[model samples]
Target chain A: MDKKGNPQIDLSQSVDFLVFWGLKTDVKAFCNQNRREKTVQLCNLSRTEKTMIRVNNLIKNYKKVEALAGVDIHVKPGEIFAYLGPNGAGKTTTIRILTGLTQASSGSCCINGFNIEKEVRQAKQQYGLVPQAINLDQELTVQENLIIHGWLYRMKSSEISSRIDALLDYVELLEKKKSQVKTLSGGMKRRLMVARALLHGPKVLFLDEPTVGLDPAIRRKIWALIKKIQTGGTTIFLTTHYIEEAEFLADRVAFLDQGRVVALDSPERLMESLGAWAIDRLVEDGMETVYFKTRNDAERFNTLKSEQYTLRRVNLEDAFLDLTGKKVK
Target chain B: MIHGIIAIYFREMLILRRRLTRQIPSWSISPFLYLTAFSYAVGHGVEIEGHTYMEFLIPGLIAMSSMTQAFAIASEINIARFYWHIFEEFQASPISKVSYVGGEVLAGMTRAMLSILVIMALGFLFGVRLNYGLAFFIALLLNSFVFASLAVALAMVVKSHADQSMLNSFIITPMAFLGGTFFPIDRLPSWAGAFLNLLPLTHASKAIRAACLNQPVSIFSYVLLFAIGVLFFSVAVRCVEKAKD
Candidate 1:
């Protein structure tokens, strides 16, 4: 529909969009009618303003290997949600599912209300993923990375140019704009990965281990950029084994363990459930006492040690160990 | 499908552009040296089927170039996946398996065509004449595309990149050699002639050579090779799709 609400688009052109997205004729017609009704009611709103990514029980197998058993996750419009799991725990497999790179054994998934298998183009239009590996063309310069990525997404020339400039500046790579990817440092390449992923201004950005191998300072820098994007209302789905990365960046974190959602909540809430304290025994001269309490109570317990023996502080590290713990039983 | 093709094309071309400088000296130039050494040094000015050895060698060289690189596309991509950790990147991108096949086919064809052009130019420079004219170029292009499709498909379906290398060495080498590469196939054993007919390269090179040598072209077999190429290409696409699953 045009500005005057005259329903200016021809049915044929709309039909083509539906075909490109792989929607069946009936489903296409249904979506078209729904969109028409919604447009009349909410004419001034942006599309992709609702849920960005949704996955239900996605499973994948490789010969005898079941990489992803069954995974279910949903990401709302504008939050940086971290998908955390140990190595080989299906984090990459889930990202592969959401991105439509591989087929799921059985499941339903979508991005921004567009079913991924049926409407891949529309689903793709919702997000970009910056992989853990550098993945940039070592032969192409930084400029070419943005240009080709933009071209892949079918962005216009002017928009591509503007986005490249803005992205380079955003990632603080403005000076290395013409430099080849091989010439960039580890941190610079990682930053370029983010820039490439954002070329089309996707509503949701998925980062797979965004800071996996980077030094602490570089990791902090990438996390800071993720924060800025999440602030700007771009939903971010990131997978990282780095607990600190998830704890600092994710608004909500799902701790995936052995292909199950062992825990899912805000990092603070998950930590709080661990009670922020530990019980330990202090024995001297063949006598001992054990105590369990919060950090404040632990502080009072610490006073007992200062007056008599020894004391220790309860922090997030201990709390994380308590829940989804890794030590021997 | 078009977007997927475009994305795959970009991805493969970008990767090739980065890797070409390193790959060319080994893959493209080294093979040229082997041809020069074999046809010029060893043949020693002998007439092959009433033509100069070099003239006899050009078509085979062109076909060999296509055959070698076309199949190597799969091995190279698979190797990139495991050795370079690059597969994770493509896996995370929204580029589908179809796009992956599309891009690889485009890139492999481009590389195959580049090799064909280089070999042809060298044959021309060396004064090797087959008198087939522009028909030769068209045949060469078709051969290039067919071999490239087969190669990309081979790369996707094969379990191991190392096995791919073996296919190139064990499978590709003998076929290119015995399929009228250095001399005419008619002078060879009868079993070899029957065997060559079964190979895709034999048809691609035969159509190209027959047209270039100005013999009556086998229009049926030319179309047949093309149809077979399309089938192989589809097989390759299906393999890639299944690989994703």
Candidate 2:
């Protein structure tokens, strides 16, 4: 009633949807849902607040160059958000800040409703971190690795065993439990990292270049595995220079350039936003991508094409190149 | 912390078992060579400290070899970590700093103890008379533990494996020589012999040799050495965790 003859809403009144619904919901059902979410969230990093990981005016200097200039990002929960940038774009630096490995010179971050600086232990508990480095213990057996993970979270021995059995079954490593990690294949080790992250049933996971060194076939396997995990309910925060990777796995993609978030949106939304751009797609030895947005635009490009290639719609890679204005560095 | 240490200890021990067969010949054979050169060659003419020159040298060589091997294990493992990127996997785990340092120290201790055992076995073959008893085992274990902790601490401080090898010519080499590992401490200048007591290994070797030659126990020296070792153990863990950070 303050103006324009309309009812004035109280700006101070805010609803706690999570707590309200959580209490009203059946505890057993809620627990089961949480259990289901644990797998999905094992690779995700999100916050209860609107922003999952908030990095404010962050600065990180590595010798002569500043890795991260002042950066700001807003991510919501349950999104397969890919953080993309060229080499040295601070994508990993931003990720490191979110995950709490490298401390920010002057900034703050939060994860799953807790401040990352003040409540780091709690923040860590909420998200599993798969670092760029291979983090599995080589001497420990597969089962031993999982047990050690559970111990990190201080999980009860009985609880850890049950979860280990279930996780080993899920990861297709039930029989490899007794085998030492050093003897496992690279793909197997990658899968073990996933299993280790899931031991404590976290709500989010931070996957930092998950498939960096794998072959295409193994990459696809890992991708499919990530997809399978996501569909079960965990949100993911991924950082990679691979355009096609972001395209294939991410729900929403954010392009980071020069320590700034250049672009952020769903793959479809991004393609639609860049309305006038046309992509000429011809793989190195095959017809991989040949797509256009406008017929007039396609006509201009037709002068350069031959009949040996197929033409289709432009993809995430095109949107990425257009938005970031740089390819993988 | 204890759990992580034990986990690392047993895990390393498991790997050690795989490498032990090769290690035995490598470490044990050198002592026999030393025994013939010092025990038989020198012993035919010289006698000092109420025993043959060979007897005095045996205990010292045992201590020197064990200390050198202990430090080398620490340095080698860390250097190997950098080359293999094994530390990255360690960093990725949720294991605390205590466990990480514990693993290195435990591995070094294992090697040192193995060397002591090898030295003990070689004592008989080389005609070095050393009595075997429960006291000897305790002395050996404690001596190795002190050397291992010091070795790990040194390893954590050294920037590179190459640097560590260089330090053996300066830091560790002098320490071994001055630590009374190669000669009777009493035979040195009185002030220098007292200075030798400052090293944990010196007291360890003394306690070990005292038990060996049926000499009277030096309780003050034993407690002081254990105290020094405990201090280094704490400090070693600190240095390792700091480097990791």
Candidate 3:
């Protein structure tokens, strides 16, 4: 203990002391005011080592209907994690619980080590959510929307203004800053949502159906923008119905079905686990897919050899279908 | 928390500012029609409780206008919830429900205050100047508080914009006309007076009319309106919390 009866630690060993004693709060209080710089560095270092978004055994029920049974997810820092699920698969429910839009019936969600239910403000500050719907204020200008987002995050006006300028430019929406959101095109509105979400500089971004209903070109633009955002070291937790979008972007993907994660792996590994090639055969009821280790092996498969089949490379969707027995919608 | 409240209020004010050109005139027409029609056409040469009809009607208009304008916030909230989805954005933000309700209630009070000003201006044009003192403004503020809180509570309870309209038609419209806005409550039958007195607006109209006419205002009216405001405000916060759930 120090002269004030506070815990004393050598300055050089503060980080180690934190690890050894597991007394982050006490150390934070000790490092308050005088060792501010050290405190920030220590906290940031600790956060970097922790999972960016952690949800454990999350469940949700609407009356008798179980929306999410027992979902578990751990998103790593600076990686693009995709949540792929069919309709009614509880993908949105997981995102909702993590983002604090709704509560999980049971279990816990932590964003950058802050529990969403208990440490709401800190957890909320750690992440920005781009919801599936376009929730931007259509009556306001693009700059105004970003400004409001910043204000909601408790950012000062000067900081909000500077971030708005930088984010609008980053989103390629600088020219549309003065334009009302209602007048913007669909892609521009989507881009504005991205700018608004990034205004507070959150460590994690939750993107729910980020590229839905967009044309191929606009979708590619958003994908590139998402990639650029990830390169800036912001962890991305994405839920998308488009399976190829997951294949093209995700560092790792989780396939959810009936409120449970059926498969979780990197895209290449998930496809490789099934095989390198997939044969699409028209069955009596519907189409069926068969996986093979090689194109030659797929050619030699005796079951679909007599039937008409198209040889194609395996994709993430085929793997999802194989694992969940349900198409990723 | 204060910053979050300011941010939400700032957003509402921004939208209001953008629509002022349309809103100002829309807010003006009702008062203008009442002042012209009732003060001249209907109540000319009519004096109730030793005051000209115009003098008596001005404060009633103030109370009614403030109530209606404050309650108008429900429509804006409905639009945000139903069409803009801005409420979802707020839900995803770090703002507390108390701050959200506080901000919305403040916006509602502001709209009420503006409508009161318009009515005061209209009364000035019609040569119906009243006391316009501290008590008058306080009563107006309390009345606005009651209705604004009610608006926020009802806004959250209503499932759709159409239900909001139905609330206005069923609750606000009847209260505006029957809650001693255009006439004296005591002049009616005792049963009717007793029933109307049960409405919060009756006390608001009584307190405001007494203050504006420079008559002795009852402390009960002030106390009761304040109590009702607090009750409605609590309900609003609770409803917002439930809506978030």
Clashes of each: 3, 9, 0
Per-residue CA lDDT of candidate 2, range A1-329, in tens? 97688888643232223332333335545654564354224324434345555555677776567788776666666677899888888887877677666666555566766555555567777778776767666766888777766765657789989999998888888899999899998888888888888778876778889988988999898899888778877778888888788889998888788777777888788878655445445667744433456867776776676544434566666676676656664
Candidate whose lDDT is highest: 3
Question: Cα lDDT for residue A30, model 1?
Answer: 84
Q: Which residue pairs come into collision in candidate 3?
A: none
lDDT of 3 by residue, A1-329 (tens): 98889987677466645533445555555644344343234345446668787777788998789999898878889999999998888888888888888867777777897777766888899998999989999999998888888889999999998888898899999998999999999999988898888889899999999999999999999999999999999999999989889999999999999999988999999999889988899889988888889988988894536888888999988888787677777
Which regions of candidate 1 deviate over 4 angstroms? A1-49, A59-70, A276-296, A303-320, A327-329, B1-7, B10-45, B85-99
What are the runs in model 3 whose C-alpha is more than 4 Å off? A1-49, A300-307
What lDDT does candidate 2 reach at residue A209? Answer: 91
Tens-digit per-residue lDDT, A7-44, candidate 1: 77577667755654454488666875674454323212
Clashes of 3: 0
Best by TM-score: 3
What lDDT score is found at residue A206 in candidate 3? 91
Model 3 C-alpha lDDT per residue in residues B203-225, reported as the tens digit of each score: 99999999989999999999999
List the candidate numbers ranked by TM-score, top first.
Answer: 3, 1, 2
Q: Report the lDDT of model 1 for residue A247.
A: 79
Each candidate's DockQ: 0.23, 0.07, 0.33
